[model samples]
Target: MSDTSALPRPLLEPPAPQPNPGASGPWTGLRTFATAPFRARAWKEFAYLIIVFVLGCLATAYLFVMVGGSLYLSVLVIGVPVLAAVILGGRVWGRIYRVLGTVLLNAELPEPPPFTFRPGPIGWLRSAFTDRTSWRALLFLLLEAALGMVVGYLVLMVVALTALVTVSPVLWAWKDPHNVDARGVSHHSMVQFGDYYIETWPRVLAFAAIGVLGCFLLPWLFRGVCFLHRVLAAWLLTPTRRDRALTELRESRRAAVDDATATLRRLERDLHDGTQARLVGIAMALGRAEERIATGGDAEELIAQARTSSKEALTELRELVRGIHPPALDLGLGPALETLAARCAIPVELRVLLPVRPSPAIEAIAYFSVAELLTNVVKHAAANRIWVAVLPTGSDALAVSVRDNGQGGALQPADASGEAVVAGGLSGLAQRARGVDGSLFVDSPVGGPTVVTLVLPLAGPQ
Candidate 1:
């Protein structure tokens, strides 16, 4: 059989399905936010929010009372300053609202409208006055502050009561000295327990039970408060559609620019080091050959060496060109990756299920990332088996992962040295991933299997 005909058949074939290019979906912050415990946590957040609100109000009121003595003093002198302070305070408060909203609501808040100015300091002042978002933000702050005071007061009462109830047994013991049911009475002279209404097992059991119940109920109450906080935060913080779209557009443009710059630099380097150098060496070899013709024996040997060198250089140049941009990428990532997996030293099981074609840049990154990881595995991992998978994570992203059964304890060189180390071209691979606004993580840990995962954003407004 011919050498080509004798080659082994591929273990897995690439899927025909192409991923959609213009698909998009909501950015559901984090998966943890969908859980029941997260909801419970959200409630606790509400309680904290109320507590903060109440404290703010009290502090503001106290400041007004202490610094602004009479109504006239407050209105004329202190009022303007206070109002200015409130406006400044509100701006600061908006940040707090955003943080809390993200934590509890797990939603992106609408950004305030952009500031525009006509010309000078007055222009700036007028711009601030004209800005609808600034006004809305200020209004949100004032409302939150007022509500916070009420919530804070309520929270304080609940907390105080909860604490008191929790310690009721101890207080009752101290007051009566005999554990009495001193209900509706200011001071009970004798401490009663059980039948005697003095220190007894029944009274002790009752006190213990009350303490346990209080402990259990306290957390639930706190959770309710947190829920309310989330509701308020969501209402105050969710960003407008226009703002979200603009932010996404900016991010996409930045990613594209980064990718383009990286590609240009890589292409320049390849041409300089690979093709350019090889052609120069070939020219030098040819010149040496023409000069050495007088010494026929030496000329023959040098010619043979030069001819071999030229062939090797040609091969390397072709490979360098292929590495820069594979023609198979246009066919689709699955086929490209399948070709890579088939060429590996160890057995590779590849599974690709993508219904839509991702952005060319993203697909290229994913393919190359998998290719590099597999190459590393074959060269260094010493594994018998490898698994590669590419799957759609969402409408706008795809998750690619490679796993191998080999010696573990593999870490990114930068992480291992506490400074970036250019080890085995790993840095280059990482930079390429980052260039596409993607992330790569390797988990090796000692003595076994290693898993590498890369998440690339797909085509569309992310």
Candidate 2:
């Protein structure tokens, strides 16, 4: 097999699907329906509608009873708890709907944080009363009680009507009506619509034909209402902006915690393996010096040997600590990369355009990433020049790109199956970037040039 591992992954996500270029006219509505059967997404959304509409009706009933009972009991001042319970119940519904959206609709909504308050029932009740998520959910419940149930009911009824009317001839043949027409004659095998009765073959077939067309159009109708459900659920069921920021803070804190843990783990390993061994050797040399002095022999050589080994070991440990946050990053990421370029074996063109300094953590990540990428290019690129640049990516991120005009068969550390290899070029760099919620993109096409970019956040968790 050929080495197909260097294929470029997407630089960024592509734009959303748009209407087909040639779709312009009467059948545009049904055009999408043709592909509905083959699309798993379409079916999932349609099934979601069928399931949620049932749940919506049940929720609508629950809200009605709770609200009506609360209003009636407010006279006794007991409705306070009732109303609070209602709001809390809405929060529960919010959880359920969010789950359904995630499992069924693939919603990327993050779970909201747990409510925080002082202990005791009074505090809990007070918090519930002031809870923003609960209030939004309660409003959503009220809306679902009125508009939501009605819309679902209407759509389901139309769907059933289409299916039933397609068998209208069967209905007409199976039924007998007790109503007497203007001639005082009993009507049999006929269905009434306002003032008209379908007692003949022509009317039956005409309605059946309309039903058939509706069957083809049902997917669109189902999808439209499902889209509305998704919109409303996303708005009410998902966390608020404050909730999102809190979630991000928690996540960033988690990433920081994990990074610290890894650093400590590495430090422990180094102390146990390398530092400990070196210290033992130094201690042995010092003991030799002590013996030589006691024997009236020259001890200077042994003492000097111990001293040099001790200094080297101490330097190694210091470097390990300094590696945690590079000292060069204190001058900012741009200048750090400039220093890196100066040290590279290949001639380089460097561009730095950072309006504001990023958080120290970000600067450290960018500096080391460029440094490693530069080393990789020098090792494998076989090229004359490397181009490195730092540019602001929107308001929140900084992008650092390294392009090499080399023999461009640089593969990101991936195996033949495209699974990431842990110990290869670009793989380690990719993992290093991801530790800070950053990403690495490689565009190496095997002939001339390779462009690798790193997108780093400007600020820490906010």
What are the per-residue Cα lDDT tens digits for candidate 2 across 1-462? Answer: 111223235343222356787867888766666666457776676677667777778887777788678767867767877877877787788888788778877876566667675578788779878888888887877776554567777877998998887887777776644457777767553567755777678887897888888877777787777677777887887788888666656665666677679889999999888888889999999999999999999999988999899998998888887777766677778777877888889998988888988998788778877887888788777889999988887788888888889877565334567543222557566656666667787776656587888877888433
TM-score of model 1 (CA atoms): 0.52
lDDT of 2 at 332: 77
RMSD to true structure for each model, in Å:
12.6, 6.6
Please provide, for model 1 over 1-462, each residue's C-alpha lDDT reduced to its tens digit, 9 standing for 90 to 100. Answer: 111112221111112245665443353433333343346664545546664665567546644653344433546764544443443444456676677566554646654544446787556555545555555565565566666676666766776775665666676567765333446443332333344542454665565576566655555555565566556655655455666556555665676677679878987887798778877877887778788775653667667777887888788777766877887887899999989988888989988889998987787778777877887887767789999888877677777878889875454233755442224445455555555565555556556576666767787224
Task: List per-prediction Cα lDDT, in the order shown.
Answer: 0.62, 0.74
Off by over 4 Å in 2: 1-53, 67-85, 99-110, 114-118, 173-200, 268-295, 314-318, 325-335, 338-349, 354-361, 372-387, 393-397, 403-452, 455-462
* Candidate 1: regions farther than 4 A off: 1-54, 58-89, 95-143, 159-216, 230-259, 277-317, 328-335, 351-363, 379-382, 389-403, 406-462
